[model samples]
Target: MSFYHTPKALSAFDAKFEAQKIAFGPISFQVAHCLLKFEVLATIDQAGEQGLSIAQLAQTNVLNEYALGVLLDMGLSMGLVWLNGDAYVLDKTGYFLLHDDMAAINLNFVQDVCYQGLFQLDKALVAGKPSGLAVFGDWQTIYPALKDLPAEAKASWFAFDHYYSDHAFPQILPLVFAHSPKHLVDIGGNTGKWALSCCEFNPEVEVTLMDFPGQLAVAKDNATKHGFAERIHTFATDLLDESRPFVEGADTYWMSQFLDCFSQEQILSILQRTAQAMTPNSQLFIVETFWDRQPSAASAYCVNATSLYFTAMANGNSRMYHSKDLIKLLHQAGLYVDEDTDNLGLGHTLLRCKRKP
Candidate 1:
């Protein structure tokens, strides 16, 4: 929070340069992607201290001198490559773009799932609907349509979704199971990853997954494959359907990387129903990547930019939330944060809530 409150970090000249970067962000993004796709960055990286010239890149890689020249010229401006005596060397930014797992996953997700759709962000904002979803198909939201998405897009989406939470699960298991819950209800349990983890963590805990039928089907299959079929059960329903009551009285309920998919009103409605179902002893844990809670400016930037994916591709009304807003919603729903843990798994925050006594 203090980071945001301080005076501007950049000088006026540097600020103007930064603004230009934003203005040309789309072009820079595609140019960077192209460099990766054509192995231009990789070739330069392999050259080490010697570096590679346009003619050398042309001779070595499939691309001609003209193609390498244009891409590498843009890369120079983008700080992805540095020019030294007519030879191009890979820069730190280029190294990360080529080898960083997080960068690769996010790049794929943006390109395959959200890039084309993002063009319609303005319309989605005005219409209060995922107007950009038309690029894929006619769907109210991206959740149910996940099963039908193109192979690359679906892969990227799931990879991006799981990467953050997967690291947190090991750390969270100890906290969640400290009290020894008998029954754990995984709300918005996509593909039963958490439920499966819970089962493996505690041999005796009964895990029930609650999600859309399509997602539950995949989760059920995974459970069966892992031979945890008996321990992990599925409860399929649309959580946003206010008339439908949630499965009640679980000892612990978990919503991981789930709530951000919804608008504020919908989140409140879901939380209210969840509170209705919780007993006095019941605990609810929410795992999310709250932008305000991020540790660094880079992580914060990533979280903030992800909000547009919701606006254009996911649901059109939800964005990555501030922690304060979520805490307020919990209070409204008769729940209060009993414990808040930050810096878990890729800048995620885990909030443990209990019914207000």
Candidate 2:
């Protein structure tokens, strides 16, 4: 089931809580986030079973009692905290919200990269462009402007990007190299992390890192520093430009966590061009977080919610896709999924496809 469950029934207290939660969602999020961010949660957790009263926590953190009380009360409703008698204590959800790797990364991404910019999502929807991205810089989209984002924003963006993609690399590397394909083209190979892993995984496999010039610079340096320079090659081109050509002859073309960055029409164009480059024997591998194929409710939540990030900040036209919808794009591109492997390294689905006969 999706994380959003419709209430078949609710008591008056529950209904009232739900209504208030929805009504004050934005400020509630800010309050709960600040509580965790400012170490208020840790303070309460350190107090253990006895818990810490609002005045005690406020004194410890040098925060006002009124502010702390309201935030803590909101956290209680948000499941980030619980009341022990009259005192406040960190709840199980709060512990995870503080310490869980995924939660922390998502939180940082939201606060640093998305929070202020999301104000213009409604405008973005109307214009079919990322209007919210204006908060960061002026550019048609975020990808080309990624290199220019403020330091903290850039860090948060890549951290969010790599967190989801990195976990899948180790699992995907073996599968990609199983065929002993000599030349594997890593489409949108950000920072060459996957290429570095590939070089380490199979020495004989040569890699062509394909992406925009901004990303390729970092990728090339990473490959060089990692001693994969001899085997690693770079292809700098904006795949969005249909006139821009892609190199051919690689037996395998790999797109990892890349396709979701474009609209369906853009995806079709990329795949169509890619299909033309493929020999009858070439295998096209697409690795993406398809919302419908996610392994858990939490993963599905992240995937679906990320669509909004794309909507407001990354690119206004694209989003996380359902597997069936992506498969339709594949067919439109004259390719077919030969194998669809799900549950590969933290909810990623790997589609092993080929040029249609």
Candidate 3:
């Protein structure tokens, strides 16, 4: 509904180049992967100031000079390499490919967990289910399937999840504790990371970690290992099951990057159940990366693309929501936003809510 304006407009020539980039995105990605896998890019990086000609590269790596030259030509257009005379040198993008944390995380996530499965995006969109999930295993959603994924795939999935959520914890802890709540519920407390954090931050606070049974076992182990076992209670239940009520003794209910895993109807249903458990004094906190609220178009692009992961791999029913859409759902579920704070971490917002008057 909103038109976002960008600072730079592509000239007609640049626009055509952009179109070509989009047309060959998959090929470009695979080339990048091959470059990394074969260490051709790394070798170039090591060559440093002098760079490497195709002759030198071929002789060193035991690759065909012409074939390496063709790939490097592609890299030239991709900004991954530059032609210095007859030699090729690594560019800024090429350097990041080898050393950047964010780049590595994203590349692994896409290649390991998402690449092959994304072919079913159109089918998932039309059927309204994660058809692409079959590539991993036949399951209702990726949550239940996480325990069974290949080790590398699981590593990528958790790494992607943690990279975004973990950094926000330090800044968010102060905000959540400002109300001085004695007991908190960590909804979707995957691996008890946040629960452990809460227990460490406050001596008086007790946390109930709520999650599916498989995840609860991991959380419990993490809590026990960290010496927070007694203070961190585990509640294992399916949040999607309406008959199973949430445990009631909580001054604050926290759902961090959780609600966006379900559809609007499911989110409303979960909120309605959460509402029933809240006392008048209880507060609900929601943390999410709303695409519309991002500071930059690039950040917005990342957030929006995550919706595709939900469509093709995660659940097929949920997405990275717009702030307006989430607020509307909150209003419908009889919760009103009492405080709205943004820019929590990379790109997240915290919504502190109370039962509607």
Candidate 4:
């Protein structure tokens, strides 16, 4: 069953409450973030089941009593904390915010990279341009500007981007290496993480990274640092520039969490160019978190919400794709899905495509 189907899980009152939550989401999010940032949640969590009163929590040197009280009051309404008599305790959701790696990474990414820019989302939608990205500078997309982003934003952006793809690497390494590819091309090779992974996976495999010069520079640094300098090569070019064709020698081509950085039309153009450069024996692997294929509603929700980040901050037209839509694009590009594997490391679906016969 599709995970996107509507459900009658909430009552009329519950639905209204949910709507109110959405209405107050921005402020509530800021309040909850402040609670975590000031270590208010940590104090309550450290207090164990005993919890802590506003006065006691303030004594921990985290925040003043007034600040603690106001944030806690909002936190209580937001369900991040609970009131047991006069004491405040962290809720399960709060626990995740404090401890879950994914949650923490996502939180940082949202706050550092997306928060301010997203204020211009309405403008972006109307103009079909990243109006929110004006907070950063005059970049057409976030990718090229990645290197120059403010320190916190750069860190959070990489953490968020790498977390999703890095988790799936170990599982996919065997599958991709099984083909015994002599040369592999890593498209949209951000920071050379996947290229490094391939180098480590196969001692003899030589990998080429295709991306903008700035990104390639970072990737090259990472490659040298990891001692894979000789094996991991760089090809600097703009994929959106249709005049530049794909570098044509690799037996294996890989794009992990990459294609979704483009609109359907752009994706088609990219796939077509790649297809044109491929030999009959070439194999291309596409890894993406297709929202419809998520393992749970929560995962699906996160993926869907991330689509807006693309619209408002990253690029103005791209989004997380449905597997069917991507597959149709692949077919239109003269490629056929030879293997469709899902549920690989954090809901990524790996589509192994080959040139149509």
Which candidate number maximizes lDDT?
Answer: 1
Score residue 81 of candidate 1 by CA lDDT. Answer: 94
Tens-place lDDT digits, model 2, residues 1-357:
353457547799989988898888788679867987788988888888889998777776867888888888889888888888989888898989877889888888988889888889899999989889999878888988888889988898989988888889889877877767889998888778888888898878999988888889898888889888999999999888989989897899999888999999999999999999999999999999999888777789788999999999988999999888899999999999998889998799999999889
Give the TM-scores of the predictions, in the order they appear. 0.98, 0.94, 0.95, 0.97
Model 2 TM-score (2 dp): 0.94
Question: Which residue segments of model 2 deviate by more than 4 Å?
Answer: 1-19
Taken over the whole model, the C-alpha lDDT of each candidate is 0.91, 0.88, 0.89, 0.89
- Where model 4 places Cα greater than 4 Å from the true spot, the runs are none
In terms of TM-score, which candidate is stronger, 3 or 4?
Answer: 4
Report the lDDT tens digits of candidate 3 across residue range 216-308. 898889989999999999899989898997978478999999998999999999998888899888999999999988878878888898899
* Model 4, span 1-357: residue lDDT tens: 355467857899999999999999889888877887888888889987779999887776657888888999998887888989999988888888888999888888999999999999999999888888989999998877887999999999989988888889899889888879899998888789888888888899999989998889988999999999999999999999999878895798988898999999999999999998899999999999999999988999899999999999988999999888999999999999998888999998888999999
TM-score of 4: 0.97
